[model samples]
Structures are given as structure tokens and as C-alpha cells.
Target: MATHRLTELPADALKMIATIAGPVHDVEMVSAGYNSEIAARLHLDNGTVFVKGLRQDHPRVWTQQREADINAFTQGLAPALRWEIRKGGWDLLGFEDLGGRHADYSPGSPDLELVLQAMRYLTSATPPSGVELKTMPQRMIAHVTDPADVRFFEGSTLLHTDWKPDNVLIVDGQARLVDWAWASSGAAWIDPALWVIWLIASGHSAADAESLAALHPAWDITPVRHIDAFACAQQRLWESIARADRPDEWTHKLHAATQAWVEHRG
Candidate 1:
């Protein structure tokens, strides 16, 4: 559920963007993103830069810094960070305008292969030095049935836990991940585990989605009990999300998908 822009960018914010990226020839508000108070495409005199930001006082403002800090390490897997500005009570980031469509995760879709390729590339990434990142166990601590299950999630691999189709773009026959706000340092198998939920939501059954996830090399080495614990944790997490005030249809769909996954794992 994306929050739509309710007003134009503040004058001071626009001025800061101009200073960093040259004059803004035009502004096109991008309404597809869930996070950020402002998401827009700035058509600059030099080039187009996609910018997303949040007011300094916003509760999730820290995510703006997280995305900025992780962009460099993402390398070819994500859009390059062009510039960043923290001014006029706002934290803004400009990124390379990757003209790409959201990836298709439907059964038999060709984009699935490219998405796996991107996942393979992501497997080798280690968190950048000096950047603090949450580990899988830390993030799922509250959701797991047994505290000991958290041990199954520990690893050094950098993970992109959010694999929504919109977060992955199909560009030039490659899948590029976006939105590193929730990036975590976790087990290599965890990324594919998270992706399996999205695949089921997009029409694949639990078994089918898992078969696809098995394409990742990490999947083979992960213990079944570890994945089972992770699936239970996901079920609890999505259940809470779905119960929130005015939860969106997508949230409920994912909850259903998680329930199916947990059942299949049993």
C-alpha cells in the first residue's frame, strides 16, 4: 500500500535538489512507492534522477539514510546512487533513472530466471564496513515460536528481505533490486525464503514457489527444520501486518500466502 503524494515538494527542498543535480527542468511525482513522503522523477537539465525522501521528523526517516548507506555495496544489483541531500528538514536521495518495468513473478514467466540471477549476485555481498545492519535473528526475534529457532537464521550474507515485484525491476534483460531500506545481514538461504512468499502471492502454489526458490544454491544446504522455523516466523509476521488498522488487500493476500507456506512446510 503506497502513500500518495498529497502536496508539491517544498520550495527549499526543490532548491537543494537543484544545487546538487543541476536545474530541475520538470518534476514528475512517482506514486508507486510505499515508503517515503516524497517520491518523484526529477527531469534535470543534465539528466533524469529518481528521488525519494522523507521529512526529517518522520518516524521512518532513518530508512532514507539506510538506503543511502547501502547503495554502494549493492553494485550491479541495484540502481546507482546519484546524489543525496539533507536540507530544509528533509532527507532526500537521487538515484539513476533505471527505465524498467516491475518484474513478473507469475507461473512460467521468463522474468523468474532473471530474478534468480540477481539473487545469485546478491548472495556474495557482505555488508559494507562501518554500516550497522540488522541480522535475520534480530529482525525475527519477536515472531519465532522458540527463541532457539533464531539460531537457524544467523549468517554473514547481506540479504534483501523484501522481494515484492515492484522492488525488482526488469531492465535490459536483467533483474535489478530496489528499496534497500529493509536490507539485512543474514543467512544466504533467507533471501530465497523471503522470495517464495511473493512467488506464491503471484499465483504459484507453495510447492511450485519453493521449487523455483530451490534454484538458488543456498537452498540445497539449508536444513528443512530451519526453513520450517522461518516459515512459521513469516506466518506470524504477516498475521500481525494483516491485523493492523485498515490493512490493505495486498497485506491480506500475503498473509494467506504465508499460511499456505506454513501448512506446506508442515
Candidate 2:
């Protein structure tokens, strides 16, 4: 998973980007996520645009197309997709430049409020017609200890299940979500449930994380059984991921937080 600086892209790829975004005067690589081989802010004479892409033959190349397809239906929470192109063995996407800092999920941080606001808005959204997204039950079927546990995740709410703090940006006092690669259609409560794990990873106690999750309207009225089931299912899911990937320190921290939530629920 080596990263490619803007300059390293082949002439054909640069030509394709220039065709849509005008000449690139400068390129600043975004060092955040690892999925992209090329991710950076391209500074043009007129303005800046964020570009991300990967090798066309990569197994996860479809995620590039998926992000573009879902961006149109994400309302304003995600940056608008400007264009997508295939060039020089790469699939690339350009997005509106949102010059913002990654969200801070630590307890008592004001960014927490903004992130919750974005989550609440997202929970109310219905996935646009003809978008074939996997339902939560289908997604969790492999992770849940009991197949019946997956039933709690079944619903039509468009859930952004990846709650990594870096995926959220606090721009102009509003929270904007990025990296829609894992977006799924699921129960409204699922997002908050996922956020609780992140909150814990950011140093909030399990009780405080649950308290923060309470800010979401959907979480307030969810059945206790469903909550418990989801907590158990997510713990199992993260545990499997941790075991399989042997992720880095931060991911292991989040997995530990998920385990704490499961114990708290028990």
C-alpha cells in the first residue's frame, strides 16, 4: 500500500486530471487514509481540489466508483464529487476541497457536538432509489455469533458505519464526513452505536460514551435488547478484524473499546 505523490502519477493520469480541473500548480499529499495510492489537494490557478485514486486493477478499485456513486446522494455532509476518470492504469476521483481539520472526539470537545449533528442528519436520510447497498443484516451475518442477532441491524436508514475521527472534518463550525467507502443501509441506531466505540477510543469512559450516544434521537428509543445484540455483534466483528489483520496500535485501541462496551452491556 505505497502512496503516490501527485507528481509520480503517469502523464496520462495527470492529463486526465488537468482536462477537468485545469492545470495543477501545486500538489500537497494528504497523509490521512491508506486506501488511496494518490490522495492530495491539487492547487490550480483558480482553486484547489482534493483528488484520490488507486490502481485500476486493484481489488478495491470498485470502492472508488462506489464513493463517486454515493457522493451524489449524501446531501451536503460529504464533499461534492466533481469528476471521475480512468487513466494510466488508475481510477481517480476529484472532490470539492474542504480545508478543515480532522474532528476531535475527546470528551468535552465541541467537535463532538458537531459530529453528532452530522450523524443525526445522516440517520434521517433514505438511500436514493436504485442504489444497491448491502443491508445491515447481510453485512453483519458473518460477524454475529447468532444469526438472529443480525435482525437488529435491519432497517432503511443510510448509516455511515466507519466512525474514525479522521473521517469527520470540522469545517466552518460544521461537521462533514469523508471516505464513504463503507457506507451501508442499516438501522438508524447503528451509527451512534458505532460512534460510541470511537468515543471510548478517544479517552471517554464507557459510561460517558454511552451518554454521548444518547444525544442521537434514534439511540434514545432503541430497544435494550437490540442495543445489547448490536454491542455483542460489533465486539465480535472487531475482534475478528483485530485477530485477522493484527492492526496497529490505534485500531487495537478501538477494538479494546468495543470490548469494553460489550462488557458494560453485559
TM-score of each: 0.97, 0.94
lDDT of 1 by residue, 1-266 (tens): 34545357778899998888888988888777588788888898777988899888888888988999899899898899998888779899999999899999999999999999999999989878888789999999999999999999999999999898989999999999988999999899999999999999999999999999999999999999999999999999999988888987779889999999999988
Candidate 2 Cα RMSD after full superposition onto the native fold (Å): 2.0
Instruction: Please give the CA lDDT of all the candidate structures.
Output: 0.90, 0.85
Tens digits of per-residue lDDT, candidate 2, 29-146, equal 7778756778888899889999999889987887788788899889689999988888778899999999899999988899999998998889778876777677889988887878
Candidate 2 off by > 4 Å: 1-12
Q: Give me the runs in candidate 1 sitting further than 4 Å from their true place.
A: 1-7
User: What TM-score quantifies how close candidate 2 is to the native fold?
Assistant: 0.94
Clash count of each predicted structure: 0, 0
